[model samples]
Target: MAQPYRPDDRSECVLAFEALEGALRCLKDDIARTERRCQEVRRAYRQLIEVAASDAELPRVEPDSRLYRLTH
Candidate 1:
């Protein structure tokens, strides 16, 4: 009977290679999700600033916010 050709450390090498591939796939998915969330935040901010522009008497920032600076 004939036997299969195998490396001296075939089992360890195969498992390590599989683990590395899985980690790379997970990292790619995370990057895509993060980019989408960033786009959503940017759009909401643009809409808020546009609405704030209509009030001429306003200083473009809320009185309770950090833009209302204290004198140093």
Candidate 2:
């Protein structure tokens, strides 16, 4: 069973709603940033694939090196 909300609880409810709204905004910002980074990685992968397909001399970059860091 649940208790009914009353007028006295209105302020608390409003405060909670505001807090939730702020958190949602932050989440949206984080999602946008992640999307941009994913796009960069995808572009880099495509470039590498194209180079590999053409039987060209591959750049001697280490797999675990920072050579693939895509600049914005």
Per-model TM-score on C-alpha atoms: 0.62, 0.62
- Could you tell me which 10 consecutive residues in candidate 1 have the lowest summed lDDT? 63-72
lDDT of 2 by residue, 29-67 (tens): 999999998898879876875677577576554556564
- Residue pairs of candidate 1 with colliding backbone atoms: none
Report, for all candidates in order, the number of backbone clashes: 0, 0
TM-score of 2: 0.62
Model 1 lDDT tens row, 1-72: 223435577886787677778888999999999988877766776666667678787557665765333211
List candidate 2 stretches off by more than 4 Å: 1-8, 56-72
For candidate 2, the per-residue lDDT at 54 reads 78
- lDDT values, one for every candidate: 0.66, 0.70
